[model samples]
Target: MYLTKAKDYLLLCKTIFSFLAGNSSNLISQREMERFMYLICLIFLSDADTTEDVTVVYGIEGKPISINCSYNLKENQWREKSWCKHISETKCQHVVSARRFWMPFLKRRNGTTAIADNIYEGILTVTINPLKKKDAGLYQCKTDFLGVVNTLQKVKVNVLTDLWETEAPEEPRVEQSISSTPSDTETKLHIIVAGLLGFKFLIAVLILIIARSLKNRTTEDGYRRENEHQLFPVTGNGYYS
Candidate 1:
């Protein structure tokens, strides 16, 4: 019985140790993965200068906007370059390609997107005329060097309406001033009412005190007269006994 108990205790301890070991391994893996991701982000940020991914273009609705994507291709070997709009977190839709002229659909849409490449200057320019609200999205410019994807940059395009341009900004301040006057007046009125009620209460308390004093004096005088009559009963008419 003693041996069996020892074996069972050992088994329980072993199982607990195994669980702890597995948990430790998982924590280590998680830490390593986090470190790896941090390194990758650092690399991406460091390469932003070369890739020109830091530019965010803003445009107003019914206006025009241009995005400049500069690249550093070795030996001026710019094999291909493409512009795409981000559809989801992990997917993008190709809008136009500078290397090929096969995007007839984009051309049909009033040729709103015009991509120009300056091979000598290593610059790619994308212009969108008459920008609409639907043009607001995340765009990416990717370069292919020697048939391999090399440099990639992303730019976010924000299209805002001109509603604020025509509205009166001072109207809100005027309304605020008007709204605040009533509250101040109400506060003063409350204070005045409270003071009047307190004055009335003081006057009532003074009246009650004066009435109590008069009643006490009258009672004292009546008691004195009764005592005198009891001590010296009236002898025949007004003679003292």
Candidate 2:
């Protein structure tokens, strides 16, 4: 519920992961480096339904879940906007069971849910006060697109029973990846920096070798000229006829 009210944990982690990659891309000197960074990013992103374009969210079982989502339901997509309760940080837990569709109007089964919340009567009083607040704007624009005259009423309903758990128990992979990313990124950065420094050192050594070779050649030529001058000297004291 906290995660739902604030921000999705999985999405927040993915945002940070992408931000790191986008900003740090300038330092990537190799294909292997970019691949490795994206692989780390995938660890944070792949667990969700990106392949199928499905979004996983979180909320409570009843009392209008505090969330309204547009997604495919029952494989038929009869209901595009699913009234979901985000029980877990990243998983939509309960789904309302509506056997009928395209009715002129819907009956409130458990406040926000038109149907599906049933069987549990114990939580009724506990949820009565917030029920109005939760289901306030649900049907505000119902007539806007449904092409039908419908109005969201403030008629109070019973508390919702913990209905069908739509999503399976998924391991929190995002938590694992987020907790360990800092150390992994730092270590990889160190390795890349060291490789870059070693390359610079190699270039410096080549330049020194070339400079020394040129200096030695100039010194040898000067020595040879001095030896030639000493070996064949013209006698200043003797005159040539």
Candidate 3:
């Protein structure tokens, strides 16, 4: 009972508000109402991620343009309390959905850079460079209310030419080359020669040391044996005398 009455009251309020939005010559003063209007535009753009369908037809070289929008619902079709509370972060879905279109809009201007005053008076405006090829796409303005939804209008942007597009080069063709260059072969040969020389030098030194050691051992053994024989005279019976 209470829920039904509250729904009735909201529907009445929306109808009255829609009239004011369209017919009232005075600008809305209340911050809440203005915010509500902003939310209405957001709902329309909830599905738009970019400004591709929305075109900036007029603007000064540096000044930004604005895109404004409004929407309404039927009295019988009003939903109960499903507005801002259900939406996250000041109704981010609308902004999130609008991103795809917004990206090209920025790139057309300066690529991922935020433009000042891109939104105004229910109208979203942006500055464009008109020279970027990626700027060319479709744009649309949409409006909706609880029960009534509308795709209000759209604009198309066309880029005549861009430096990026014009200056692009053809893909290169690289052929694998095989070569036995003199410098590289010479380096390898020199390394091999040096290694062989080092090995020969090491072998020569080892051989000399081993031979000298064996010769000294042999000479010492011979002298020791001779000294033994001299100290003890060997008789014919094999006894030392």
Candidate 4:
């Protein structure tokens, strides 16, 4: 639809061109010349793609992100530029009003929004700091020429609440070699250590009990043995003594 209108506008321009060329003897008025020039400028600025060239920009909530808008560096560097929230092709709410005179290299910041135009690079960068969910929507980079605003770029901003919502790069897989069973040698060593410890503990206990029993028997026997003259003491098993 736009292409057809552009073609018709171009045909009109050609007709105007023919009129100027054919009527060389008849001088054109200053107002007529200005109108012709305005029409040509309008046609040049209004040329657009069939579908809007909208670049999708993803930003994390509470983080700063910048959107770049490129334009004809030769002609548009000195023109008034704006950063706006786009409602429709012709209608937009200006986020930051158009700067009448944009200094080529300086960055201008207004609250949370910033605009930096680099004429040498032919890129206008709009930075939004600590973005909110409400800031997510369609936006435009606009340039004003002779009272007509031309959109230099269209951007769709998406502010994500979670970092995980963004697509993450895939990690490489690692291959590990592992065996679940224990080695025979290790099992045998453990068993041997356990057995030695148990054996030693049992032998020490037995020796301690025997020494205690002998000491007790000797003390009970020496002075209280029956007849008091035997190499071996006899303990009275049947009586209370």
Candidate 5:
């Protein structure tokens, strides 16, 4: 029974490591990762104001995790409110920053760490989706600017419940019309509908212009005919002089 449990835990860790490897592009920026770790620590310690007790000291779990946050003036305002409320204030960018900090920690399981070459180098997005109970741990995120390293954020994730579920990605659902027509018929129908609509509009415009021109031409022709009849005098009402 103990061996089975141990094997399960190992499998979970492997799953997390594979996930990180697939998204190596996201792990490139160390600064963003550092900030994300700090954010997770804050989430874990939401119940306690300070880390005076052993529970808080040990953190929610034994593992040490890191996250990264990028510096952006527009997002800083939002981060302040998010720090307390855990709700964003029109700073989606800051929310994204926080997520970057959370990803690595959430991806971790047990005490195993997944490290890669240049995991924290430049701009990257670290994300932890569908957070699990195992994700709760000691988290840190740091960044180096101009060769000066600064710890931008630190946080610990603590999960009290046995079941941990992260947010699911929303997928766009498309309903295709049920029709199994030949390719030629489908193409013809599409082209015909488009052509008819375009031709109808063009015809309407042309008719209006042509009607106005014809009316003007008719009026001019009538005036010219009347002038000719007046100039040529009729002798005694159709009797020859």
Candidate 6:
């Protein structure tokens, strides 16, 4: 039984060591390797504590922002959790803690910052309200487990001063419909007016021609009667004189 227990313990330690070695080998950045080593030591040794730096986060100025930190506890029991601002590579300023008093500088708040933790899910969230340009900096979330302080994650927040603006396209103007040809009703009315004027002109010309013909016939008849009277003298009683 003693041999079996010893073998199991050795196996567990081997697994952990292999995992740490594999992770360290995969890291390309020297800073990342250093952070990995720090975390490994914090986990293996009681007196050592370290923070693992994470990805950078971006936020627009005057906006609310939330940063998430996730970690695996690996069966270790955590007694406390904290959120801090990175002062330097090897130092941090504690802002809030799960089981401790808030830092003196953070005691008075304008409802601008908060932190929450989920022990079961191993997630820590830091929130900032109305984020300003001054809030752009490095931050860390840490946990105290097995009498050792270990960094869950670190983040660099960058607050942008310029907010994106989208201009809506101008609405297209509606053009009034134009027609080159007249409507059916107007065209018909115009044709009728032209026909009426042409009929009136034709009637006037016919009337003038008939009147001239009648005047010429009347003059000829009078001249013939005068010639007959000059050619033969007619008695006053209806005979030629």
Top lDDT hit: 4
Query: Largest TM-score belongs to which candidate?
Result: 4
Tell me the tens digit of each residue's lDDT in model 2 across 38-130: 345334443432233233222233433332222222332342222334344444333343333454124344543454211121011112223
Query: Which stretches of model 1 miss by more than 4 angstroms?
Result: 1-54, 99-110, 145-147, 163-241
Rank by lDDT, highest first: 4, 1, 6, 3, 5, 2
lDDT of 6 by residue, 1-241 (tens): 2333323533454455546646664213333343444344333332111224356665657878877777674542244677788889889888766533333113223257777665566666678888988788888888876678787777777664421121224555658967687775676588789889999999999999999999999999999999988998887798875
lDDT (C-alpha, whole model) for all candidates: 0.63, 0.40, 0.42, 0.70, 0.41, 0.63
Model 5 — which ten-residue stretch has the worst lDDT?
77-86
TM-score of 6: 0.40
Candidate 3 TM-score over all chains jointly: 0.25
- Badly placed stretches (over 4 Å) of model 3 are 1-182
Clashing pairs in 4: none
The clash tally of candidate 6 reads 6
Off by over 4 Å in 6: 1-53, 73-77, 99-111, 145-147, 165-241
Error of 1 at 42 (Å): 28
lDDT of 4 by residue, 133-238 (tens): 9888889998988898888988878665532223335656658956676675676577789889999999999999999999999988866775454555546884
User: On residues 54-123, what C-alpha lDDT tens digit does candidate 3 reach at each position?
Assistant: 4333212232333332223342122111110113322312211122223322322234222221222223
Worst 10 residues of 4 by lDDT: 160-169
Q: Which ten residues in a row have the lowest lDDT in candidate 6?
A: 42-51
TM-score for candidate 1? 0.41
RMSD of each: 24.7, 17.9, 27.9, 32.7, 19.6, 33.9
Model 5 residue 60 lDDT score: 24
**Residue-level lDDT tens digits of model 1 in 1-241:** 2323323533444454445445664324333343344334333333332334445555657877877877774643345777888899788787877743343213222268877666666777788998888998888888766677644578877674543233325444444343434454576577789889999999999999999999999999999999999998888878878
Query: Which digits, one per residue and each the tens of the lDDT, describe model 5 over residues 29-77?
Result: 3333333444453443443433432122222233343333344433331
Q: Of 2 and 6, which scores higher on TM-score?
A: 6
Q: Is candidate 2 or candidate 4 better by TM-score?
A: 4
